[model samples]
Target chain A: MKARLRNFLVALLALAGHLALTSPAAAATADPLPSWREGPARQAIVKFVQTATDRASAGFVPPAERIATFDNDGTLWTEHPMYTQLAFALDRIRELAPQHPEWKTQQPFKAVLDNDLEALAAGGEKGLLELVMASHAGMSTAEFEALVSDWFKKARHPRFKKPYTELTFQPMLELLAYLRSNGFKTYIVSGGGIEFMRPMTEAVYGIPPEQVIGSSIKTRYEMQEGKPVLTRLPEINFIDDKTGKPIGINTFIGRRPVAAFGNSDGDREMLEWTGAGKGARLMMLVLHDDAEREYAYGPANGLPDTKFGTFSQSTMDEAKQKGWIVISMKNDWQRVFSFQPETMNPAKK
Target chain B: MKARLRNFLVALLALAGHLALTSPAAAATADPLPSWREGPARQAIVKFVQTATDRASAGFVPPAERIATFDNDGTLWTEHPMYTQLAFALDRIRELAPQHPEWKTQQPFKAVLDNDLEALAAGGEKGLLELVMASHAGMSTAEFEALVSDWFKKARHPRFKKPYTELTFQPMLELLAYLRSNGFKTYIVSGGGIEFMRPMTEAVYGIPPEQVIGSSIKTRYEMQEGKPVLTRLPEINFIDDKTGKPIGINTFIGRRPVAAFGNSDGDREMLEWTGAGKGARLMMLVLHDDAEREYAYGPANGLPDTKFGTFSQSTMDEAKQKGWIVISMKNDWQRVFSFQPETMNPAKK
Candidate 1:
């Protein structure tokens, strides 16, 4: 009788241990957005997701209709020290300077080579387009992809001293995964070059190439040396910024997004489009107000104006009027990036 | 003893019944492409899929990289008796004829209204663009979707007396399902307008709106009577035909497709692009040679030339040289469409 009682006790203990081990996993799933601190911003996101996903709710959005778009630059990662793509272009221009000696005399090229910020800014949109055309074009699609992938491996953020891929916000990553867990199809709708983003989005942001919609230069298909090649052309195809954001979204996605996240006025149209849709919706702006952790910007915090990703006073007012949630990075996020500064190779700086 | 013997007999009978019912289901799964008749075309497809999917095979492709693209018009459905979009445009013009009295005197409009195919063809690509812009634009995306959905419900084919949605090929449907089952992501990359196809693709071909890439018109986001609207503008965006096929595929998908299927010269570049990729690839062109079942128009089998979807001699010669499979519809497909003609409404014709 004592032996049988011992066996029963052992079985009960094993069952208790198993339940203890698995309970946290169940709790973890219940709290999908763990990185996000419990606040109105997080609450709004959670509420929208619950209402959208709940079958019995009047605001229930079908699984197929759950389209969510996120802007990459300031919203997902550090776009402050400079826009990541712009930094890449600058690096590319410096590498290619030896091939084009005339760049020494050219205004914008000379500005880029000399690292003259004021001169480069003076060149404005036209000058930026010229730089983009020079650095991004004149290669096959396959070659360009390889070059971008290689750069991503070596390039480190100037301030963070970490790989640019590691600079992605942990809170935003959690949000993306959380939304996806609830049957939402997440897309990156950015003003950045489509090809530039496609190489790394799947790895860094969990966004597939087909789900990314962005600006692009013209690419021509030709038979080169008996092989089919898509040669990038030095011409403007589409610019997916400002009003063009909605156009790009419409052209590529064909369906209006139910949720949009951004950090600048460039994303205003995308948010408006998302908000316009009937029923439950989510439109958010990440207000960078933590200079101690991440770089602070926008008209709200009295931070210096940035040409890379501007958040003017008007944009803040629009967000306020439209009831779009303003996410405070300092207060809302438990962790800013996926990596710590000391862990990275400081010598890469 | 008698009761025990009876129970054993019942158990034996139950096992036999279960085996009899399940054997066909097991066999059906073993043969994935059932609608495709046993021939070289079907064999080539199966071989490519097997090699690409097998982990030990040299041509093994990862699931994420297993992308397959299909052309919609001639390849998925009947493009003869005029392209479906053109038919839709013509019908729309007639419906809006009272609102646009000037269309009575307009060159292309007059040609369409009079049902003069020769005159419309003479007006060429420019005329078609004008007609498309007039019919497809000036409405919100939602309104356009509703209009398209309504048209699909009411519009009957001239010869088949069936809705265009029901005219999709059975063999191709089986092929799509087969590819998807084997962990391939299927997309429709066509020359047809993106908006026009998105409404029906999900219902007819099991492809969602986001997976459909095609030509588009510019749409602007605006406020109309205090409600947000995306107004379609009358301007050509990207065209996804001929050389544009590869460009569109590169722009939208970013990854090169492992298998591409089409039925015309418009798909030549796309097939070439797919064929150029390393390892096991399947490039197929559907030859419309069964006049009794479907329309036949190509440079092969003494069929008449067609302006809509031309499969020219050069395209055929290239396919031969490249070893691309030319699918003979008459020989390879046991059935053409999903439905029979007798089941459709004859009076609608």
Candidate 2:
């Protein structure tokens, strides 16, 4: 009897949340996504959300099953002056250099301290792992979170000259809001450290800590002065990238996503897993074609490629072959960040 | 521009969900938890929810942070005679005995096949891991879920003569609903396998699969006939018991819970982690003192201890010292299960 009542109660709450977005006062506007220009990419997203939420439509999905995942790096914010996490690590190395004199001579540490990007890139994943272990662990979760928040207070994006939090794509923020209004739970499925992202996600993306799934290090529970603390351990627990992206999604969220968006090869598996679900799915890859506005380096346009967020030719080919929508930044978005002057979407103003 | 709008939109939706439970028609009832008898235990819960949700009160917690976690085996359902998972494992061994004739001679398998509970008890944790690996892995996640569903269809609790799902505590179910009605997001953080619990959590407890966190085995994503499937491997990825409880909560939920409930020492860290957080917190343990209504085995009140869900004397003492509520099943609950006749909660009558 309680279970039945509980289900009814939950359904009512879900319905209330759903109604908040679909109500006339909220979504009655002619253009739900004003920043999205008139293009197939914009049309695909708008159409999918409409069809999926319409109870009379065959594509209608239950409110509880309306889960959508977004890749964090280049997809949601800037990852191109280097992946934001990599930049954080390099800055951390410099911050701690005075305390550790030996780091000046250490191979990877020396490269970072010397500001030699070429030498640091040459050290590859091994070097990056070393930097992450040094910078991201060996403290209580509370302390780590405090450190991250402190860093974010002063850390400015090298290219945009704006705070990292401010660099989040304004159009994407609108989509997240639109999805939530329609009862879709938006989650950040990222390769970045989970701890690193949780501190700012709620402020920047409106995604609270629990909805973020990403790479993690092991944490241990210890008693300090008769108080419990979860201490971070410098061991890799799970990596949420490439094939790991799908695994992370499946493990963290037991439901398959109805919509997924990403920008690079690292997100191909996530898009594949989401598209494989039986329904009207919206799978999109953001193409960084507008170097004039944002960073663009991918094999898709014969641009110079970097190890960070690689958009390979094969992944581009697969997106076409599998019928996934490719979002062209230069054409589809009226404006990338809200700070910029509105490009004025052709369909609007 | 969109960020401010998104915040307003999200706040509106959150308010809508909150009002669903607090509405006159829903919360107008005199007692939200009817199965809870008159006592300090019941009073404490009522007071906590009232204060926590009261915006004018200092104890008020935001809806997003109103996360509650519950332990599955003992707290939510009966765990005596042996855990439900243990029963499943032993039954699985018997089901596969025809194919693996070697099991007719193997140690733990022989013990299970021979119907010798004493020998199986003597094998301990190592032997149990072997049984779990043998039965729970070497199949796709989808296949494992189907197997779990099939088992639930026929498997009955030995003492109750009802399905395991039907054995959940009525008062606890009421508590779960009461919390949700007040805008709390309840989660199951159990020592049981994640896949094993997810198949039935939504139906039995009104908790969805994504909200359930538990022990897991390694899973690798692979392409099977051009379709993606996650294959469960025969290696333990995590064990969500003992100190592991806090780690699992932190790793998956990323927020310390405002409330936590459990029945054994395995949940000590989780409770401690929760209580350590600032705010009005409710940490509770279920004491099964009603031998007539359900199985009672613990160190408390001279009850015989068992390997499954052990309630240690030290943990009982610590609960008192820490001011965590210890709920006596005999004294507090009006009825154990929904199918039972109402004992007529003293205050209600």
Candidate 3:
């Protein structure tokens, strides 16, 4: 009887030790999306990845065909107060104001100089293009890359006060890593300038330059002082937004993505294109509904409509009709940015 | 004494078995470029790859930055008897001739139908664009891919009497595989239409569609019968030749290539741009000097210059001055094509 009791006790201890070793690892594997709250949005992503990766599943996608595209601006990071690229352009104009004394009297340049965003907005697309050309062009690609890199090193967001790179969504970053781990190639199909995004994409999003498709201005190859240089020109080459999104994806990737994530009306066509593919696919839109953590400006719940990343009612309707997942920032995420608010040291105004 | 002899025999047998198993594997690793004969061209390639991959070497490049670009036509495959794409276009025009009655009288169309090369050359770039649009555009990207794939399956070269896809350079194919084995990404940066090359690149060159950078026509995205389709437009979007080569590389790849290979003046800017980068770089030009195996039409050795892939005297001079390795087809290649002449079964005339 004593031998039986001792054996039972030993078996119990062995079982406990095995559980201890495997529990954490099992938990990690089970909940790949820890930042995502237990909701429909997270469930859909998990299910799609599971089905696509399972060899026996009807929706099994080969690794080569497992392409996932994400929009950059509001989907990946903060595009509030203004677009990060626009902010860069404004700052660039200010930096060059000293070079052109006429900028002190010029309408759009003066508006930017005085921090008058309303007037700058009133100047419209033409005014914005002028600012982009003046700031983004006239330098070799190498020089422009350095200039953008230097700016990113010092620039801080107006509201969050964090460096722009730090403002990337923690949940999205986790999602990117998770997808990549599951043999899905993640690409950034953004409306931002290709050169502007290529410099920092690898470091920030773990996405290489070749995987990024974005807007671009023309660049010319020439021999300057017996050395080859790619000089950036002021003319616009391609805009990767709205209808252009699908076209750009076809042009660059030459493959239809199985899944797509975006935050605005600009992403509607891309999502539709992805959903139209004949397979189990995922389409997600991140709704900015948390006023405390991030700016809320979607056309949802009487939120003010903003031009930065316009999430229109029609887009919401389309998502509903197509059964696309609408990810609520307030209800779905356990965290927003990577760093805690207290840790962010805002630059002096 | 009998036991001792048995032991010695077992040991000798074990040594012989081990040598037999490892010999082929060791040879494969030692000589990555088996098709490339012992010459400066092969030496340059072997040296560059070794230095770039060696972690202890000063010229060590990370796996991500080891990008190698190659021109498609004359460099990777035969461009003589006109470009492969041009032949495909002519066949397509003939196939569609029965449908269009007006084409029977059209100048370029008549020239194509009658097999008049002189008249087709007189029609020039504008006429080529017309043929391309008629044959390549108006169809969906998927449909175009199927068309090209079907054509490649049946089409045969006039001189080689083999399928055009089978005419790919054996040495370059070996080079591509070697580069890929050493952690380098091989990309086809060609002047051919992006769509035309994509179908065959993967099957013939082991390059996926996304890695191909080439000329393109404008495509529009639209929902037809509730399904999204990208329709190729009858307009030129961008060209990928000469100065355009560098631009295309920048636009699609967003990274400067560490190594570049080409066969004509059209590749001058791409090689120059690649060589201008910091650290060790390699630029090579394939000089077509073998008349028996491949047509010789360069300015070298008093050969007749053809418009297809013109290697002018100035280009040769520049290549010499820049220290770009010139590969002589006759001397540097042990084999030209994957298939021997005896195996080819030409299509019915």
Candidate 4:
């Protein structure tokens, strides 16, 4: 019996050696989340996730109920001086400006046509909304999707001169995929138009249209060629921005996600909803502090060049009190946009 | 260095001895998904999932985009004779029936009051829709939710004489949690009213309202007490049953799911959409084939005691050809509803 035990021990040792040999060297190391910097923002995120996932932890959320929501324009990707969608729309305006002579004469369209970023930014939400309505609305959902798809393939960021999809933040992209791998459903809740987003959302955000919650225009089901087709109408359906984000989420999804992320104060309600829930929740706000890496802007003295809405002292205070994570773009991320080094020549100070 | 290695090895051996001393003999393994029986349907599911999750296997799917959709009602829980919502509504009707003398004169209500389920079933979708609209519509979303929650607490299934929520299959409940642990997002795409499903969805299915896609009545945002309130209207919004399920999924979810489940032909399109999509997908259908254990029903010959929509053989053939799994309740599940033994008296053969 002792000899048999010795043989069993020898076999176990041999098996362990085989496993060690087959495993990659990198697989054995304790690596933190790849793009995460070592600090409170990172620490808070890691700690929250760890507790939620650890079976022994007090805050352990069942893996099934682990739902995470992210804002698209700024939180998940780069929303600089203006949203990427606005930039894309502006480019479309330029491309179609000559065809519609009235655009050259119109106030907002003329500003867009003249390449007057200052004057265009002066329009604010109302003016910008009008521009979006004129340029984005009126077309059928399918046609609009096709147009956006074509534009995405060809349109390049004016400053970065890279494909718009490539402008997505690499760190956040990795984080989204990582969270999903760890049993979280990542949804894109943005202020961008729903139709404008659906075309590229799957490929870029790894979130499909159903998971994408944004501003929407009313649509109707119509029979075209003996088959039912959804047609986008010019009427305002639901605008899922600002305080509307939470309301939209509640209306569309019907569940308050455990984890929420955003860049601007527009996302304040969503973050509050996420963190204020009964069980364990994590809310993150991305602060674009690195002007050279991306545009730096908050509520104070709004720079027309700054794209995202704004992050306030009130929001920051709430973040602190509620144990919400505030990610400093300047410090918290080793890498910013996916197009870094390749497309963006970091602006000279 | 050799002496230190020997000491470490000795310590490891001691630890192993301690582990063996503490470890209890393995208990007889219970079926993890006890509601299912041992059959081809069960085998197909286990085999497909195992192969799909195996990284080195040919069918390995990257874990990030694993999304599964399920048809509620018969697919996940019981939707016999009438939907569970209708059951709630009926209970509400009976409780409120004393208050409204007008219901005594109404056709469907008259049938309901008379306990003529046969006559009520004869009314079909149109009649059921009318009944649902009358009982479920014209209240604030919150009010409706409260009503649902109130009904859930008191309402019991007529046959089983247990709360309807308690009748949910235990194995399916575990499967939902298990799939989520394995990086799958479980969504309910049902034909029931969205609001009707939302109130109890989180508690019962571990799925929130946002994850639920169902038929809906029109609603509008109204400012009530200086806050936005969604007021449910008495008009049809989106119907999410039969062909509507696929359409609802397409419009609301936007992405094709990696997996889908349903019991009847109403879920045929949803299954087709998932399995026929590009890349890896798993589709399943629950077959109610055990009369002794639970109700056995299909289009050919189903339970006369209870009735709902049924599926055809062609649909089963299609599922077989497309590699979709069909789970037999009698064969695959070891246990049926969570309330089994305690709540339900197993039908004597």
Candidate 5:
């Protein structure tokens, strides 16, 4: 009886193995919109995307017309305290300072080297522009690209201590992918220099260099030793900020985006332009609110000395009145930066 | 006896059905490379491509790094008598002549409108450059893009009377596809304006706008009513001709192509650059030698007015010695142009 039982068990096991081998195990998992924290804003966005993508839905748009524009600095990634490009430019200054003796005694450069946040902050746009121009200009586009690639490899953020690219919001990456899968041709329409963003945009954002519309510097072609060269000029060619965003988009793309995203008043025109378009349009603004997970300070909500600041409530009120999607970072996102792994343990102390 | 007869009839019918299904008589006829005449040159290309692409062979390079650069104008399509862009610019002059009254009285414009090929050609480089600059510049990038899209729709080639894009070489298109299948990133490094090439590259060559590197005009960014505008300047920018070809390729792509193809000495530098690179480089030149089948041309054999005339026997010898693949149009190509159907039949009547 024991021998019979053993033989029966072996036969069953063989049958199970045969069934498993013959089964269609390579079936792809269905990719749905990732579950966002349940809320009215999330619901509206989900509904819009679903309706627009659905063939049977009344709000359905043709795949060819499904263009979406996204702001990179704040909407797609964390831009707290200051824009990431500023951070990159600042780090570049430090790396380059040793080569130039004058910078050791320079006002802004000295402030940057000394880590005097107050003095650097006081420098404002004029100071920042000088810092950027000194560090970013002069290199050939190819040289600049290599420099950026090198910087990305070594530099880490002051607070997060993680690579700047790693600080990109996980939820936003999912949204970009979701939008793409739904037949949207996503673009980065921002105030960033076109060349500066072109180097890393493809790897980090999946947006090609050509699709990135931004501010640009004047370039001239000159024949040096019978070979043509593209030289970058220090002159300001275009400033893609505030109201300039919409016009830049219109001029470059020749068509209006069906959806737009932004985090500050700088992107107000882009959102306004998208919302003004006919038929289906979706616009969203990311409001920073989590103090523990992320630094939070709106014009009305933060401590006087806090570095983080937000747009006036009037802008949020305007967004609400316009039926725009205002995402509350604290309430909507399941997680912030995707690079942070799920579990963290202190090294055996 | 009846049962035996019925069984015999069933067997005979079954045999007939099996033969009908299995035999070539019931199968579709295969397509031959119809345009290609039987020749040793054609045989060599076909055999080499087949051997290289075969997975069983030792020489299997992945498609991503299979960079193939082709010269525009003559190599891929017909640019005989006059370059295609020149024709477009002349037509543009005529279109804009009414708007600019001065053009009607002008030498080049008058010649263009009057259909005097002699007078138009008389203008040479000075007049041609001026005409091109006037017709091509002063518009926003968007306006120029729209103009191209519109012009392509209506303009017909003077010789073929078909759309210029339709005049592309059919065999080359097949070769491009075959190369792509085997892992090649094809690019058109042309002497044409970058903006001019971009509007139609995707539709005509299947090359994305960003992949095309060519001559360009300086553009400036201006804030017009709060929007950034990229204004095309009248000043000459990069001239991607002669030695500039290789330099442009290096600047834009940051790597040397493995394979390069051209039809003229304008492509000499490009071919040289490709050959100079280490390891398994393939450089081919399309020698136009079939006047009967297409247009006959060589620095020694055809068209005196051609920019570099044609390839000389001594030049051909040097190319051969350098291990370059010289594709004789008369021998290698199956078809000269994609519009052969129209050429073959003037009318159904």
Candidate 6:
């Protein structure tokens, strides 16, 4: 029995060594955020996580309280050609155009159908709200989810010529996983429709639906033909942008985030709210300065101004003044999308 | 080296044997629900958990989909005489009476102050709303949380003559742990104030604030003295009762519950919605039939009717027709509160 135990122990040691050599955790520890180039922003995030997780450190945060919030649109994915949800809304409008012949003559609907971007912008918030109501609501939640899922399956980014999910910021994805591995509950606090995001967030971002807080339309529970359904209403219930981001975080998460990330003025309040929390804190804003690689229209750092995801000059000033790390797409990111050739797009490669 | 390895293996095996004997998991498996008597209801819960968790079982639910919802008030704790929230509201009226001199002359306030149950009941819904709004709103979120925490520290149940937190059903607590052990994520879906419940739910029920979905008043996000604060506003944002329960579950959880527990007609929609799910489902109602032990007011099994948590005869009929289990307080629960002497109260013992 003693001889057998000795042989078994030697074999176990050999197996332990083999497992250690192959473990992902061991490899992950070397460079958790490899997509992020060595920069102040990456250093800031790593330092915050280290201090917050270190048991002996004064800045240590309990795992239960290690909440981190991230904005979805410009922060996580490409919002350049227009927000993905807007793209979905436009496609939906065209798909349903035959059913509604009046849309051909309408302002926003006609703009979308005729591929007139300027006309859609001129119609403004009211036009956007109308489009959202028409496309996103008036169906059972399950049916709406199915529609969104089907759209995601087929819809491709106009510029990237790939699915919207493929356009996610690889550096941010790594950061999310890193925070999660460090015991932080990473949440998407977005201005996008809650129902629209819920269908795909888990698969694309690794953040579950319950963790994704966003703008929402009201839903009513009713029985139809002896079956229960939650019907999505056209009326807007909540807007999870600007000041609404903080409110949404408070309402859904019920905890203060120690770390926050956003790329535009819309996320200003959320950053402020998160920064106000005590102990180790990290807040970052992604700067779209790499115009050659990705569409750069921050209107901050002398980039061309665009209506979508406005990163104002004043917001940049605030980021500097408040000690919030500003990530330069040109400098901080080694790669933006997973589908992109390691360091550059195939055209550049 | 061989002798040392053999000795280490023998010691390791002995330590493992000792740990196995002493492990909480080993003891827990013996009887996960000691507070639940051997009955159809307890058996039903155990069987459902087993079938749902077993990977080989046809009714197996993935860990991610093992969502269980519970109603708070009468289902988790004693809700007789008046809801604990109602009691808190009345206490607040008295506490703030000197500041609000007009409250001395006000109908509901006067009724509360004078301890005239008849007059308070006569004032009805309007009176209750006035109490709720005045007591619940106008404070900053942090301040409100502090106030609630302070109240819970001192507040004692009128009947139990113990802290209200101590009045929580031990059987339910055990059941919650059991479900959690079986990989279920338990959430409290209640008609009570979200803020009121959030402060103590983590400590009391082992349910986090984010998992506690309840009715809430509107809150405004603002900068006060260069610090961000969310001020509670006196407008009803949501009422998570009846049909609203299903809507709340869908809106917050974004998934149908596999199991639901409640005690009243208000929870009918929640239970029904949960049961409508395709997989293994468990729907149960707590029938308060032990008047001698706990105040019985189901009005379900010919018990006395009450204003709060009215489990009507019609609801009982629906439960039967739907094949939902009705838990008898007299028979099903071996013990209620942890403070209640082992099997019975001192008088009965």
Tens-place lDDT digits, model 1, residues A56-148: 998899998999999999999989788999999999999999999999999799999999989999999899989999999999999999989
lDDT at B171 for candidate 2? 96
TM-score of chain A of each: 0.89, 0.90, 0.90, 0.85, 0.84, 0.91
lDDT for each residue of candidate 2 in A114-214, tens digit (9 for 90 to 100): 88989988998998999999988888999999988988998898888898888888778888998899999999999999999999999999999989999
Model 2, runs deviating above 4 Å: A1-30, A344-349, B1-28, B344-349
Worst 10 residues of 6 chain B by lDDT: B1-10
TM-score of the candidate numbered 6?
Answer: 0.93
Error of 1 at A308 (Å): 2.4
TM-score of each: 0.90, 0.92, 0.90, 0.67, 0.70, 0.93
Off by over 4 Å in 1: A1-30, A341-349, B1-30, B341-349
Preferred candidate (DockQ higher): 1 or 6:
6
* Superposed model 3: Cα runs more than 4 Å off: A1-30, A341-349, B1-30, B341-349
Q: Which candidate wins on DockQ? A: 6
**What is the DockQ ranking, best to worst?**
6, 2, 1, 3, 4, 5
Q: Could you tell me the TM-score of chain B in model 5? A: 0.81
lDDT of 1 by residue, B231-300 (tens): 8889887899989888998888899999999989899999999999888899999998877778778785
Q: Candidate 3 vs candidate 6: which has greater TM-score?
A: 6
Candidate 3 lDDT, tens digit per residue, B166-246?
A: 889889999999999989999999999999998888889999889999999999998899888999999999999999999
Instruction: Summarize candidate 6's per-residue lDDT along A1-349 as a digit string, tens digits.
Output: 3445545655665655455556664445577888887768888988999999999999899988999999999899999879999999999999999999999898889999999999999999999999999998889999999999999999988877999988888999999999999899989999999889999999998988888888999988889999888899999999999999998888887899999999999999999999998899999998887766777786787877787889999999989899999998878888887877675843334
Q: Could you tell me the TM-score of chain A in candidate 3?
A: 0.90
Candidate 3, B-chain TM: 0.89
Per-residue CA lDDT of candidate 6, range B105-177, in tens?
8898999989999999999989999999999998999999998889988998887788888878899999999
lDDT tens digits, residue span A24-83, model 5? 542344545343556776777778888888899877888767889988877787777777
Supply DockQ values for each candidate.
Answer: 0.31, 0.36, 0.27, 0.19, 0.08, 0.41
Model 6 alpha-carbon miss at residue A1, Å: 13
